[model samples]
Target: MPDQVLELAGVAVLVCDPAGPPVTTTQDALDLIGAAFLGAEVVAVPASRLNEDFFSLGTGFAGEVMQKFVNYRLRLAVLGDISRHLAASSALRALVHESNRAGHVWFLPDLDALEARLTTPT
Candidate 1:
């Protein structure tokens, strides 16, 4: 299925298909960012769609991809449970903790949580 736009809490979010291509490189992230430009204020990517390198902070892949979203003023919501990845890396856990506190990037457990965040005033 192609990416679909959702209007949640008065925000336009491009929800990427979990079965779609993996986001492995910075360029791939850029492609999503560009796509979101059409009518989305945020881009929701499934945790399964992210590359392994993204969870490994040493590779800086997560930072690179997230920075692109930040630079473009487009929020990124990573959906699905990533407890396994969080269990393996303390750095990633810390990153997620911090990112969740901000408005730029979010690592949500599911779409319901994303909607809650969207509905709540930041």
Candidate 2:
């Protein structure tokens, strides 16, 4: 599926397709600046499209990517069901919880949840 930009409420969001190449590195995160600059305040990337290391809390892959997004002042939502990975690691669950609370990095269950976040009055 081709990637596209969407408007959730008044928020401009860019939803990346899971079918494309995985964004696994810090450089990949920086590469997304093009979309952000184009008025994408939020980016929704599927969990399946992320590198496995992102789920391995010890690897710090998620943190690196999140940092890049945060530096750009753009929000990131990791969408789709990641139950298996979460079931395997309590640390990941805790990390996700903390990240969600931060409001910049989110691990959402689906696109609808991402839409909610974008639409919810903040």
Give the poorly placed runs of model 1, Cα more than 4 Å off: none
Candidate 2 ranges with C-alpha deviation above 4 Å: none
**lDDT per residue as tens, model 1, 20-51:** 99999999999999899899999999999999
Write candidate 2's Cα lDDT for 45-121 as tens digits.
88888899999979988788888888889999999888899999999999888887777889898888888777675
> Local error of candidate 1 at 110, Å?
1.3
Best by lDDT: 1
Candidate 1: give the clashing pairs.
Answer: none
Score residue 32 of candidate 1 by CA lDDT: 96
